[model samples]
Target: MTVHTGAPRWWRATTGIAVPCLVAAACGVMLWSSAAPVVDFVYFMLAGWALVLLGIAWLVLVVIGWFRYRTVRRTLLAPAVVAPAFVLVTAALVVVQAPFRLGFLVSKPALADAAADCTYSLEHRRIGVYSVRSTREFDGGCLFFTQGGLIDSVGIAYLPEGVPHLGAPRHDGDIGYDHIGGDWYRFVERF
Candidate 1:
């Protein structure tokens, strides 16, 4: 019986470094996208767990590679480096997401207040009501009211400190006003 132990040089190099590098990049993108609001909540959650799992899998592959090919120690470095990179990337993602989550929490009260004020008025007398809706499409939080409502508007709020320039609420449509100076905005639909 013959036992095959050595892998081809190219195979070892590709698997050791190239594959791990690709995986790490993918994991980083997933984590980043998950945090940046490009992906939905379910995808974000899945990507987060996938990153962790990929890190673990890379570590395991490195260990297996280390044992399988005694001569290709250099190849094992890929996964070795990738495992920690994954962890760091995931940590960074969490750190980046923390503020957004905190901002959402902080802004909830303001949103509720705005919704209440917009929904009720002496003249309109509760013709309609503003309701809290998922802001996933807008990448933050929003309160929306329908037409003929006391106030038909979409209110968007961001982190008070780190307002994202890219996804900031549009001010060109309808009658827009700054609800909280710079961090919050409301766009009232034109009647």
Candidate 2:
């Protein structure tokens, strides 16, 4: 009886790279999905089902591979090889430095063009020019909450061209304002 010593070189190269890439892509998708809920909301019917199918396929493959092979090392190495790449890619994506802030849209009128004249109002609070042709709204209003705010309300505006970094909030309940929480240079993107 012959025991397989290791995965074939081609298998290592292909699955090692491809599996991690797929998993990395999945991670990116998952991250973006969290930051942008529109996907789950709009594509939940089809994309959600597709995600379930992908998950099922993954489980089936795991079971088949486990039954076909006796060693855990062989069964797991293919996916493991890509783990570093996943971390590297994810980190690169998360840590990108930008001089300008990126705003994500959180609410309705999904079909509107990336507008320069958009406005947002919450109750009596008004946030005008919250977005522009240059400033993009991805997913939906994900960044609006962080962009501008009162203690209870948040606002954001996009300059059609570009503008100086607007001052942080000084007074309470001011539209297009927010109290500075940290270093303005390092703006963290949150969901």
Candidate 3:
């Protein structure tokens, strides 16, 4: 076994640390995109930018690592292993909609309580984990609306009777309601 002498920590990091970070950042971007409706859009965009910066940092490290350790190994000069793993994991996430499903599960209870408290109120309020901009009662459940962006909004509704446009992905040009599961449905409007 050939020992790598006079190698800087960053050189090792190209393979050891940077590759893993690159894969993680990619996964984060994917998961955040799926969960964006329930999360703060500002933070989501910021996270995307941060992930871009991380990818750039990893690329720079790999370039320097390759020049310095030209004779070391090809593995250090590329994201060979982690890249394929990222692809496979991303495919799985897309197939299952894991993040969106998880966001629904985690935010459901808090949103249910918020809906209960907003029956007669129209003012902005923070109830438990979710912020409610407005609320409306349906057949036997409630719809809680929250701002996802300046031109976009998302709602977490407990519609046991089912979403109005459950099967239709888009109600009109910019309005839509998509079912999550059970009594949970995602209400999205792009204004």
Give the Cα-based TM-score of candidate 2 against the true structure: 0.35
Q: lDDT score, residue 96, model 1?
A: 70
lDDT of 2 by residue, 73-130 (tens): 6656646435545645544553451111222333223312323333342223212323
Better of 1 and 3 by TM-score: 3
User: CA RMSD for every model?
Assistant: 13.5, 11.0, 5.0
lDDT ranking from best candidate downward:
3, 1, 2
Strongest candidate by lDDT: 3
Which regions in candidate 1 have their CA more than 4 angstroms from the true location?
1-14, 36-39, 75-80, 98-155, 158-182, 185-191
Clashing residue pair totals per candidate (backbone < 3 A): 0, 10, 0
Candidate 3 residue runs with Cα over 4 Å from true position: 1-5, 13-33, 36-42, 71-95, 113-118, 122-129, 138-140, 167-175
What TM-score does each of the candidates earn?
0.41, 0.35, 0.64
Once fitted onto the true fold, the runs of candidate 2 whose alpha carbons sit more than 4 angstroms away are: 1-17, 36-40, 43-51, 78-191
Q: In model 3, which range of ten residues has the least summed lDDT?
A: 166-175
Worst-scoring 10-residue span by lDDT in model 2: 181-190
Q: Residue 149 of candidate 3: its Cα lDDT?
A: 52
Residue 158 lDDT, candidate 3, scale 0-100: 77
